[model samples]
Target: MDIPSNHSNHDALWLPFTANRQFRSTPRMLVSAHGMYYKDDRGHDVLDGCAGLWCVNAGHTRPRIVEAVQKTVATLDFAPAFQMGHPLAFEAADRVARLAPGNLNHVFFCNSGSEAGDSALKIALAYQRLRGEGTRTRLIGRERGYHGVGFGGISVGGISGNRKLYGTMLGGVDHLPHTLDLERNAFSRGQPEHGAELADALERIVTLHDASTIAAVIVEPMAGSTGVLPAPKGYLKRLRDICTKHGILLIFDEVITGFGRLGASFAAEKYGIVPDIMTVAKGITNGTVPMGANIVSDTVFDAFMQGPPEAIDLPHGYTYTAHPIACAAAIATLDTYAEEHLFERAAALTPYFEDAAHSLRGLPNVVDIRNEGLVAGIELAPRDAKTTRAYEIFDRAFHEGVLLRYTGDIVAVSPPLIVEKAEIDRIFETIGRLIRQVA
Candidate 1:
């Protein structure tokens, strides 16, 4: 593999979700990746702790996925998703629908998780209108939720920083309080014992605006980007019950938790509760190719089919909606998960992963440690300056030959599902050592 020639220059490109000036001054570049390790620009092996932004569940550069993408691009690179049809698209959508829980048997393709959010919101609104409930235009989200960065997503998303700079967002968006109760549920393993009552906040919101005006409620079953906050026991079921009673749609943004992150095929399966709609990305193609999708229930699809036999049902879709190569990559990714039994692998590793995570409980600056399945978040006491402690730990961990993700004051870990027991030990062990060193 050839490295980019301009290794020293960082002026032309502006990075996303990064401190541009700080990063340009001290860049940490990944040149290649394999299995659970990434080779940096200096050729140092850095143990992957975040699965390439929580996507590459099957590990890096699997031969089967590579072959699929290669064969696809060489044969049919692009296909017009509008009116024109492609075999791989149908095949990929079918595979995803089959993996989805409950009656979510229909799939709509998009470019990324952000697009998936926007597409799901549109589907909810459209589904309501098609059912003669055009008044149901309101959407509900939860505080601290990270639903990607689209206009529609940002509007309903409750992260203030992500929404502050961008003037007024969409109207009729309300947020339920976040479920993270550090004072009451800190350092608890798996789902915290408290906070199930927090789900009732939706009922309050529903009463404020009336359920007839609310179209859907979107949330991450296991909130990832805003720090790993798994839903409390019974919290999701309560939300599902509320949405069902009100005839409101429920959308689960499973971009990070989808494809075996939560010890099951999806978080819906892990909790035994099904959502009205599901948005997925990241692991759908095992991070080898860019793809996202919105899977809806049969009721939503059938409602759109009622207008006319030849009429265009939903007035939405992307140009690259099911690109042949993406479909091929997705098909191969599903095959990889099944053949390797990675979902079961994740479930089996939870106990060991939990113990390793909790072992850091007494480390300096460690305030909270949350773990579920293969994901864990170690929250540090914030420095006088916000985010300073977390960034320091992140930078130090990278230099010490391990890659970790830092969001706000929390250091998150979610290695590939293909990770071995030894690799898991190394990941948490390195983080524990780094935390002590920072002390």
Candidate 2:
């Protein structure tokens, strides 16, 4: 494979969630990737530590996914999603629904996690109206929660930087207090013991706004993008109870936690709590293709089914919703997961991954370490108020032949589920050595 020339024009694209100026000054480029590693421009083996931004659960460039995508693009590249259908689209929906928990038997397809978030929110609002509760238009989100970048997602999302420039988002949107407490739950493994009471903030929000006005409450079960803050023990179940008591739909934005990232098919299955509506993406097609979905329970799907025989039930979808190639990739991806027993493999590797992550404790500037399943976050005490330490570490790690992710002075390690124990050690070892050198 030929690497793009370093001297090539690099200003034509504006990268998302990246420092474009700094990247242009010194670009870290990858030419190719296979199982567990990426070949950089210089042809160095860079071990994947974040699984290509928390997707690619299976790993890079798997044979089945590649072949499926190739065959699909050749035969049928595009298909109209509105009032039309394809066999692969229906087949993909069936595969995803079978893996979902409970009676989450219906799937609405989209192109990315952002679209999935917006679609799930719209479905909740529409379901409420269809059930004769048109006044239930308010949406609730939690502090430090990350859904995606869509207008509805940003409105319900609580990341300050993601919301500050957008100005006042959708009206009647409220946020529950975040459950990240390093002081109380530092160095904890799996689910933290404290902060379960934080879920009661939902009840308070319900009292303040009244249950009749709320449509749904959306949250990330592990809060991956906000630096891997796993939910407190009993935290999710408490929220589920409150939402059930108040008749508000509970939406789990499982974009990052879906498809074996949490050692199970989804965070819902791992935690034994089923939300009314679930938005999923990322690993649905193993990051080989762009695809997402909103999986809803029978009750929610049935409500929309009643008022439509000849009429369109839902008046929303993207032009590429369930595109033929994406559907083919999804079906092949699900087949790969089942045939390889990757979910069970992830479950078995959790202990080794967790121990490797926690071994980095007591290192310089390391403040807190929290991990669950295969995902871990090592938060550093900031060198300055700007929180540049982790970014520095991330930059150094990439050039040092390992790739990692950083956000707000926190370094997160979530390798592909196919990673071996030795690869897991290498990821943490590189991260540890770099953290010491940064300060």
Residue pairs whose backbone atoms clash in candidate 2? none
Candidate 2 residue 64 Cα shift, in angstroms, is 0.8
Regions more than 4 Å wrong, model 1: 1-8
* For model 1, the run of ten residues with the poorest summed lDDT: 382-391
Q: Where's the lowest-lDDT run of ten residues in candidate 2? A: 381-390
Cα lDDT, model 2, residue 23: 93
Please provide the root mean square deviation of candidate 1 (C-alpha atoms, Å).
2.6
How would you encode candidate 1's per-residue C-alpha lDDT over 148-252 as one tens digit per residue? 899999988888889999999999899989999989999989999999999999999988999999999999999998889999999999999999999999999
Question: If scored against the real structure, what TM-score would every candidate get?
Answer: 0.97, 0.97
RMSD of each: 2.6, 2.7
lDDT of 2 by residue, 1-439 (tens): 9878655488888899988988999999999999999999998999999989898899999999999999989999899999999999999999999999998999999999999999999999999999999999999998999989988999999899999998899899999998899889999999999998999999999889899999999999999999998999999999999999999999999999999998999999999999999999999998888999999999999998884499889999999999999999899889989999999999999999999999999999899998988899999987655547889889999999889999988999989989999999888998889888886
C-alpha RMSD (angstroms) for model 2: 2.7
